[model samples]
Target: MATVSEFVIERIREWGVRRVFGYPGDGIGEFDGALGKAERAGEGLEYIRPTHEEIAAFMATAHAKFTGEVGVCIATSSPGGFHLINGLYDAKMDNQPVVAIVGQQGLDSLGTFNQQESHLERTFSDVAAYVQTIVSPAQAQAVVDTAFRTAITRLQPCVIILPHDVQGQKMVEPGPEMWQSRSSAVAPSIRIAPPLEQLQAAADVINAGERVTFLVGAGANGATAEVLEAAELAGAGVITSLRGKQVVPSDVPFHTQQLGLLGSRASYQQMKDCDTLVLLGTNYPYGQFLPATGQARAVQIDLRPEQLGMRYPTEVSIWADVKATLDGLLPLLTRKEDRSWQEKVIADMAKWDDELTAQAEQTYDDGVNPRRVYQELNKRLPAGAIVTADAGTTADWYGHYIRLHDGMLGDLSGRLASMLAAMPYAEAAKFAFPDRAVVCTIGDGAFQMLGMNELITIKKYLSRWSDPTFIVLVLHNDDLTQVSWEMRTEDGNPVWSTSQDVESVDYAGWARLLGFNGITVTEDDDVAAAWDAAFAHRGVTLIDAHTSKNVPPLPPHITFEFAKNTAKALLSGDPEGFGAIKDSATSLVTEGVERVKGALRRDDRDHGDDGS
Candidate 1:
């Protein structure tokens, strides 16, 4: 009969989990042993040992996002499991499928004060979609099944807590049959087709409108063709949320642009000018950019009924799959042959795209042009390349300039905007997709936060893979510039701030010391050359591009007002007001700008001042 370790390995194999990411600890020793046995037996599953448990979770999150499958991570008891919370929260927020198996304190030590003992279930209750603890060997199979189902079905993180005693205990009876089937869980209460009356009503609204707009979101992932067809049929302009940017090609004629903080003016303008707006699986939270009642009718279609009218008010909410709804409505709608509105929106999109391209092409002597580097990399990187980004200024640069190709995948921790997620995410990507090129772009501050330790994880994974190649680009600005700039008052006085001195650490040298090929480039002209060398290297490679700390990100038009207020508060040394300003400055600025812009376009004199 197979031992507990053997059973665990068999279960992982049954689930078709090719790789696992996490650090090892005493509580997880049995599972580690099981992994070793499986590897020796040629089960094809490999363990990726990352430096930090949080990094492990981030890597798993990336794997899930890229592969559209349940990515798994394992951690030890107490602090180890605690470390996974940050990344797990990110996965939950992004609706990515990820499963975490956390080692719990031995069952014998339950209710007693012991080292590494903590309330694992309560700790992760808020962050995870579902949490379960395996108290006995008999409960293992059910717990695992529930955890996997919860994660895949909800497209969120699930935690399975396994105590060492339960993991090591011998099962008195045979475990449940190993379920080898691999299928995504059905979205609860999804209707493939909308009600006939509602569908015709939506069609009538579109057919009657002179100018129609289609806004797509990430939830429209599988309905790309239908969305494009609907736009063509109705002569409507198309705009996407940031999450939906890559769902449709940006170069599509009717594809206006994205709308939000990092969105282009063309998309926002088109939304306001339209007579009718069709929201296809989008829950865009910024209502200021959306049209008010009586200006334009908003029709929303989504598989999840709960998400239909959660954000912006919808005139018609269809509870149907995006593709089916579009297919049904297309035949009922009258095709408008007029290309005037389409041409105008397309031209605006082109102009915005050109402006961005021109801005990215600009060269600076002292600073490394991050835009230039991103453009060059985008041109040269292989199709389906997995790119992971660290938060801060680097994220802003990538969000504004980088254009993803058809098969390319990009992953980043949003909302919280944590630093140091890139390198570890890259490692996890490599483990999950060994054949695809994995690239990580990180800022100097973010790189330093988790850089030195990830090399060992890379080396360990490299040794395991038959042929491993990981490329990392560190934007070496030599300072924590984002925060530093934010803390500077308008009068050029330093407010509440930390020293920008970065100690000038040699990132390339550190990479070399960690047994990877490292290249350092100081000149802008050497960037391509460094990239070429790093890509050509067979194993892990790091390219440190020395950049200027003063190359601040372009201020968003909406952020100016908040910036003024924050600067004023800082100058006056009003700690309370400064704190308030700091908390809501970015969001308030975005709302203020949109409100003003919307009012300006309406051409109503009686309306309040646009500056308000």
Candidate 2:
């Protein structure tokens, strides 16, 4: 007779889960034994054990996001399960498919306050699309199957609770033949394209509007050509959610930039002035960034009907797959003859790009401007590199400076904005594609927080990867710069000593100790060489580039209210605060002036050409 745990593992393998991320613990002994047996026989799944359950969860999340496979993570009872929440939430908010299997205390001790006993179902309810507890061996197969299916179908986390006692129980019908048949017969969930009529309606809305803007999200993953075709037909400007940044190549003429706090001014202007807003596969949460109702008619297309117009009011809401919908709409689209609006948006994007370039080229007091660091990194970035950034200033730099090319996969903690996710995501990305270049840009404080320990996980797994170019680019400013900017701009307060102060560590030296090719760079002149070296290295590399602490992560559109708050903080008896404000203002104002001059020069050239 097969044990219940064996059936559970079989069910997971049946779903094509070859590798799982997790750590071993007390209540998971039976499952662990089954895993060990499978490994000994050299026939089944591989378990990747991270030091912390949290890292395991993050690794799983990253695996799902990068590979488009259902990621799995396992943990022991209460504390272990609890640690998985933050990473699970990252998967949930980003709409990635992942399943978490958590062990529980014996069913008999349910109400007796057993060791590490907690209601995991209730705890995981908010984060998961499906949550269930396996009470008996009979329920094991169904529960595991349901969890895997729900996770993939819903694109969210699914949790299954298995009590220690139930794990050891005998399965009624589980054997080698049963497992073999299950694995062979199981198929992925099929998704049908949206109806032709709905796609036509969306096209009609585009034809009716004079100036339409395409606001895309992560849902439009594989429909890049369709999107660009539609944009060309409609003469539309393209703006993306941070998650959708990789959808529209930054170098494209119609692509303005991202929208919202981390977005560009060109994106905001395009959205503000457009007569129609077409939302594709993105539930962009910031309604404020979108054109107000009555200002512009809106149309939303998404896979799920419930997400339609949830963020902004819509005229037509189409429920369908993004690629399929675009496929249907492309033929029906009435090509626009007038390209004035599109050209205008493109011109604005050029101006913004110039201003940004000017800012990036300027060296600050510390002789290292982080913007310049990103510019250099972006210039030297290898084709098809998988890039990840921690939440905060590092992400801001990536959004503002880096131009994602075609075939390059990039991920940030989109809605969750969780720190320390970048490093683990990079590790997972490298693991998934051992031949690809996987790089993580992280803040110093964030690197110190959770990323420091995960380096060991990367080091341990490095040997398995074949010629992996795994690089960790640490922005060593020794402070929580993003939070400091937030406190100043939002609360009108000087950055508290605790937020501004962090002990600087020799990150390169630390990585060197762990057998990685480590290089510490403090000069701006050495930035490019460091990147070149890291990307060229066959093994793991760490580039600890010390940057200026005073440089703030300025938003694309600076509001008067934010400026007022920042001024108040600067004047509120803080010398460092004043210096920060002055430096940021100088850089921005200088860039603005340069942009104006460039525009004037372009106008003069155009006039001179006409006269000639």
Candidate 3:
């Protein structure tokens, strides 16, 4: 008879899972042994063990994001399971389907203070949609089936725990009439779309307004053509959430890159001025950047029913797959006769482009401008490249500079915004599509935290990938840059020197030690050459970019309250404030000009004013 561990391994592949990310431990020794036997036979999942269980979980989530399949990760009890939580929370927050298989002590060891004995159900309850522990051999199949099912249907993480002894036990067949003898089948692919009446109602809202803005999100993946068709028909300006940045081409005339602090000024104005807001598959959390309450008549369409109308008040809501819903609604929308609104959006983006160029070229005393790193890479990115960014300043630069062409992919921890996910995510992308080049953009603070370990994991698997262009763009600012900025902008406080400073590392040295090409960059003149060498390298390459600590990753719009607080903090002798203020003086002037432009436009609407 097959052992329970062997059966579980086989069952997941039947559900179309080909890869499993994990770290090993004695608690899961039985499952590891079974997997080993299958690998020898060349008939099992391609399991990749990350440096840590946390990286494993991060890889699992990234696999799901890149492949659009349920990602599976295995771990042992206690520390292994605990380490997986942050990455699991990342998946839970991002609404990705991931299944975690964790191990525990034997059933006999319950309440006996056994080593690595953990009741993971209580711990994972908050992050996982379904949590269960297998007890009897008869219960194995049902538990495994339910975990995958729940994860797929709910678009959330699921946890399955197995006691150490139970996995290695002989498979015992229960009597047919027994309650535990239930059989299960693999789930089939599914597509969902709302009824015609609901789609028609949403289209009616779009057709009623002249200045419409479409806010797109990751849920709109695979619906690029539909988004464009619907937008063209309505003459709408497109604003994507960071998660949905790759869903549409950044170069489109009507598209205004992204919307939020890390987003574009054009995106900000598109939201502020639009009379109609059409939300497509996005629950963009920041409400202030959106039109004020009662400012726009809104329409929201999404696959998740619970997400509809929760962010903003919508006159019509459609709960369905974004691609199918848009296809259905295309006929109902009427092409706008006036192209003025879209033309104005195009002009705004063009103007914002000039502002971004000016910001990127600003001189920094310590090193090259931080924004210049992303800007240079944006120009040199190869076709079909996959880009991943860690949380903090990297995300700011990525959101501000990186442009995703069709067929290219880009993602990060998004909602959870975890620090070290970018490296693992880039690794997983390489695993999922070995032929595609992957560029990981991360800051020094995050890179020092677990990202360096994952580089070893990359070294282990680098030969397996067909494309040799695996690049790690490490920004060295010697500070927890994002947190420092948040303290200055959000809290209205000076930079806390003790907690914010980071220990510098030879980021390129580590890569060279691992037998890969490594480049250290400090001067602005060396930036382009560093990127060129990294991309052209036939193996993993690291660019240790010494960026300026004082470069502020400015928001699309700064609130008056935040401005006053920033002034106060600078006046209070924030260590880096003076230099940062000097660097950002031109940006302040540009913001003031935009504000005047906005005031005149609003005043025009208030009175009866002529066209621009």
Candidate 4:
């Protein structure tokens, strides 16, 4: 004699879901009350109630990304469902499997314009791969199954809407083999390979080229070894997209960090100069950074067929799983003996690293350079750590500085590019892998938006993690720096102070108030000390890095158009701010002089002699 709510929870648990991220409201009272009873009985799913429904959905999406599990989130109707949209879009745009269960006003009040009434079906139609509402208890079990299956199979968000009254109904099971319908928990196991002809065609394009650049994306997850082996055979240098940043280890000789606006000069050069481009598991949308349409012969492998040739025109496109396709195609690729192209890519990466380090080390009179905070973070990041960053200059610094060692994990809201995801992502990562260290880098705006309220959620759940190494790095620039830079570069206008500047708040003080080990730093020398102290603690730490907004998030390879717009903006107004930007820019340009000197010294030492 179980209630429909209880039956639904049991069904999801059978699908291997142990955690449910959500918030409670009167709309979902039946489910919430049942969950409490089950928890008291020691049979309920582990429920994590984030401060806001939006964060609950964010946690669910992040859970899917970090754990490769079908993440589940629940919310009440109308406003609660409305808040879940942004986070649901994060999963949809990034292609993660997430299932959301939303409650609605009673079925009897369908057309009554009731309080908290919502037409969740029409609202969720776009974000969900499959969305359905259950009118009967019999539909509860099957609806959950379909939602989860669709999420896993398509790697997209799916929705299940339950009216408040429907959840209170008694669970029903169909009598043996009648006209009554039922569904099972079995989901399809998916690992696909493109046809031999497709794989061979892709191989032919890659094998025939003298210089190959492999642009890896998020789809390459769990296929790093196969990718590296193929790279060696094709004599290709590696360039990871932002989402694919962790696919290749940071230390690989020919593996350029990332490619695009927040990428490396090495990656930019390799993409521009390469004769062949082999795209793996990534649909990197920035075509401008890629070779001009027909400059290179290209082969693309993606799970989605529509993505195959949509971004960059490909000579051969394969619809297949990245690892499976690579497994079949590896033997066909010809191994190249020439190492010159790869060596040059490695050298360019070294020079870029030097320049970036110089940029990070540049002193600021007003505040600590944000680049320096990420640089220091990279230096101190523990082995096998999980890193998450908010959207803004935080992503730029993360892209440039943090070199994710092998086994390390890092991700963000890439396509959605939303804020307030960093803290939730970090918390989800920590929950998924309690033994691992987790870090979140966020800006003041994002941190203030919802991150502050989630501190209480984090503090409440602190005891759940065995390793207490969750660190939050908040950039206290008191400005929405990314938009400021965008206006300067894209619109050739000065920063609109009223819109761009954020009010200064004591970020560290709030963290301390919440019982986290909070530290505020403004000077260059204190950066390393702050990181060290945070690592040394046996609890969560928040480092309020008072960073300078003036130091622009410089693009890896600036186009002439960008340079011109930047110059125009600098001359327009805001001379004092632009002057600091000029200094930061100068350091990046002239840092190569030091790198050249160091390289020459190494060469002279190699040729010089004990023979002397």
Candidate 5:
């Protein structure tokens, strides 16, 4: 008879979990002891312990996104489970598959006052797709199996509560065949098909339109080629959501640009001008930017029926896989040669890309621009590097400038954009794929939020592993300038920016004190060299790049009313009071101003030159 520790190892093997991301704790002694025993038995499984449970969650999220597998993360009770909520929220919003196993206090102490006895199920209910507590040995196998299936089927995070008392209790030996058969259970299938009338109606709309566009989303995964084929047949351009950036290569001819707050202006313009809009596997949140009622006919195709017509009004909704729908519609539609519309959209894309790139290149006299630093990092990092980005300005910069390549794996805590996710994410990636480059980019303000506390965990990993190498790039802007900029009034007076002054600190000293290699860089030219040094180190390393705080994040559009209010607040020296409205207003104003300028320039160029 195997001990509970041995039973867990067998269970993990049955679940096909190759790696586990977590932090060991007294609450999880049974699981931890089982992991140790399994390691000794050469199970070929690894347990990656990160600095925090949130980081563990981030790492698990990245793994699922990159590998297309249900990533697993384990944590102890209450405090540990609480830390994982943010990352789980990210996974839920992004629709990534992840399974989190949280150890509970001993079953003997249930409902009686005890340490770490908070309601785990209630705490995680909002973020998880399914939550189950395994209180008895008889229910353990079934609960675990259900949790795995729920995670995959819903394409979201699931939580499994493992009580300590149950884990240590002896159980009647269930035959080996019973466990074997459970492990071999097949995943449920998703069947999708389009109604004949809806399909034909969509095809007719596409065939009749002179200008058509397709907006792709994460749901379009594994159908890139089919989408491109359909677009080619229709002579249409393509725009994608942020999650769908790499669905089709950026260099594809029909690729216009991304569309959203961090999206390019050209894509928005194309979407507005389109005669018919085909939403393929996308549930874009900003319906205001989409074609308004009666402006352009909307046709949607998706695997999930609920996504159809949920956000926007649609003329035709096809409940089918994007690939299948495209394949079925291709031969039925008329192929039209509309070179004029395609040329106009392409030209707009080029102009937007050029203008944004040029604006990002503008140098400030005070210090290095963080945008430039990110751009440099984008260019210098390895092609297949795993990059984790923390929230705030760093996330803004990464979203706008960092191009997603074929081998590169990147993750940003979208909905739960908390600080300190990057470090633990990097640690997990390093542990999972020791050969791949693991890097993290974080802001100065966000870095300090959970920085020092996690260093000990990182140090332990580095000292234990032989070839430990994880590179962290810190954008040392010296202040929470994102908030400061929001507080600026219309007259350029800063009303709320004075709360925090830029304080210079030796970030490298802190890293060295934490038993990791650290390099501080101030010059623009030395940034690449410093990165090279950090990457070359055989342990955890930090590159602190001192950057300018005044550089603004110019999004694609903003309303005039918002801009006026922000400007008024800044001018009145009440910037902080308007803090809630500053970031959005500033982004809108900056982008709006740039867009107007570009439009005026184009109008002048068209009207000034020779008339064809």
Candidate 6:
């Protein structure tokens, strides 16, 4: 008879899980033993032990994102289980398929307040699609099956709580023939498709509109070709949600930029002006960025029925795979002859590109410009490189300036927008695809928050990689710049001094101590060369580039109120804030002035008769 641990591992292996990101602890001995035994055998699944439970969870989330399979992570009871919360929430919010196996105290403890025992199912209910405890040995197989199935089908985190006693119990014997046959059955492949009537209804709505805008998301990843075809036929200007940034290539003719606060001016204008919006598998939560009610009609399509119209009032909702739905709807679409709307949006995108390029090229007074760092990285990015960005100023530069080329994939920390996910995500990407070059842009503030320990995790796994090409770009601004902006906006000056202040550390030296190839970049001239050196390094590398904290991540459409409030706060107290505002405004005005001068010169030449 197989022990519960053996059976559980066997089942997960049968489901095609190759690696389990986890850490061992008190209540998980039996499961740990099983992993070891399997590894000793030729058919073992690799058990990668990260330094912390949170790192393991993030790694699992990234694994699932990089691959289409359900990623698994494990942690021991109570505190260990709690550590998995942040990463699990990250997975849940991002809608990645992840399975978390939590070790619980012995079943006999019986509500006596055992050490490291807590109500895990209750804690995880909000974050997981399936949350349950294996109360008995008989329930083990069924619980595992359900957890795997639910996570895969729903594309969310699933939790399986296995008590110490339950994990040690012997699996009940089914007949040899029955067990052999049943064990081979993996999770079934299921595809969701909408009815013909619903598809036709969506098509009718889309066809009726003169100016259509397509907002795509993560769910539309593999449907790029089909999305372009549908956009062409419908005369739709495409805008991506941040998570869907790489879905529609920036090089595409009709494709604009992302939407919401970190979006582009072209995207904002497109959404504001479109008559009808087509949401293809993207439930972009910010309704403010979308067309207000009564302004435009909407057609939302998704695999999940509940997600339909959750963000906006839709004229028609179709429950189906994005590509499949598009394939069915395309043939019915009335091809539009007027490409004026699309052409105008594309031109606006070109102008926005020029603005961003100018912003990236401009040098800061005190330090190397942050945008220039991304610009340098963009120039040096290897073929098929996987990039990850953290949530502060680095995200601002990465999101605004870096252009994703074809065949490249990336992770945007979606709903959580959590700090320090960049390093873990990049490390996980490297682990998942060792051959691919992995780069992460992280802020010094976020690096101090959760990045140091993860560097050790990378060092631990670096030796295993045949072609390790992991690079971390430390945008060392020495402040919580995002929070600083918030403080400057509403509160007049940052009062939470400890929270915003980041201690200056030689990150390159620190990385060197952790056994990584370290490079420090302080000058603009060395930025590209530093990145090239990091890429050329055979192992894990870190490039610490000192950048300015004064720069702000201005939104695509900054309201007068926001600017007024910010100016009020800055003028009232801080000179740095005043300087930032003055410099940014001056740069924009200067660019505008130059453009006007160029326009006048062109007009004069056009009207002037050849030197007469």
TM-score, each model?
A: 0.82, 0.95, 0.95, 0.96, 0.85, 0.94
Decide which is better by TM-score, 3 or 6: 3
Total clashing pairs for each candidate: 0, 0, 0, 0, 10, 0
> Local error of candidate 3 at 66, Å?
0.6
Q: Quick one: best TM-score, which candidate?
A: 4
Q: Rate the local accuracy (lDDT) of all candidates.
A: 0.73, 0.84, 0.89, 0.88, 0.73, 0.82
Where is model 3 poorest over a 10-residue stretch in terms of lDDT? 181-190
Query: Once model 5 is optimally superposed onto the true structure by TM-score, how far is the C-alpha of residue 116 displaced, in angstroms?
Result: 2.1
Candidate 2 per-residue C-alpha lDDT over 479-518 given as tens digits, one digit per residue, 9 for 90 to 100: 7888888888899998787657779999999999998899
Candidate 2, which ten residues in sequence have the lowest lDDT sum?
176-185
Off by over 4 Å in 4: 175-180, 575-578, 591-612
lDDT for 353 in candidate 3 is 78
Q: List candidate 6 stretches off by more than 4 Å.
A: 174-185, 490-496, 590-612
True-vs-predicted CA distance for residue 150, candidate 2, Å? 1.3
Clashing pairs in 5: 487-575, 488-570, 489-567, 489-569, 489-570, 489-571, 490-567, 490-571, 495-573, 558-588
Candidate 6, 156-247: lDDT as tens digits: 99999999988889987433443231333367654666788888898888888988999999888788888999999988899988778778
Q: What residue runs in model 2 are displaced by over 4 Å at the alpha carbon?
A: 174-190, 609-612
Model 1 / residue 228 / CA error / Å? 2.2
- Expressed as tens digits, the lDDT of each residue in 284-321 for candidate 3 is 99998999999999999887789999999999988778
True-structure RMSD, every candidate = 7.3, 2.9, 3.4, 2.2, 4.7, 3.1
| Residue 459 lDDT, candidate 4, scale 0-100 | 91
